[model samples]
Target: MSLANHLEELQRKHGDIERQIDIALSHPSIDDLEIVDLKRRKLAIKDEIEKLKASPTTH
Candidate 1:
């Protein structure tokens, strides 16, 4: 896939993670560790998106 497509997909995943985190926060039954993991995954995806945006390549 092209870089733009990849970035778009990453952004979608990040948004989905955000929604999951929100849902997890709303429910007391959700485990703390699960929320933490979701946050970590979200952060990682954000970092990746930033990295891709900063890169010079168009691919």
Candidate 2:
């Protein structure tokens, strides 16, 4: 797959993770660890997207 496609997928995954975080927060038993992990994943994906945007593309 192209790098742009990969970045798009990562962006979608980040959106899903954000939603999951919101849902987790609403629950009475908030999984703090899970929330933190998801946030970390989101940040990682964001960083990846940024890198993809900055990098030059062939096509």
Write candidate 1's Cα lDDT for 1-59 as tens digits. 98999999999999999999999999999999999999999999999999999888954
Off by over 4 Å in 2: none
lDDT of 2: 0.88
Candidate 2: tens digits of C-alpha lDDT, residues 1-59: 97868978998999999999999989969879988998999899899888888877723
User: Model 1, 45: alpha-carbon shift in Å?
Assistant: 0.1
- Pairs of colliding residues, candidate 1: none
Full-model lDDT for every candidate? 0.97, 0.88
Q: Lowest-lDDT window of 10 residues in candidate 1?
A: 50-59
Off by over 4 Å in 1: none
TM-score of each: 0.96, 0.87
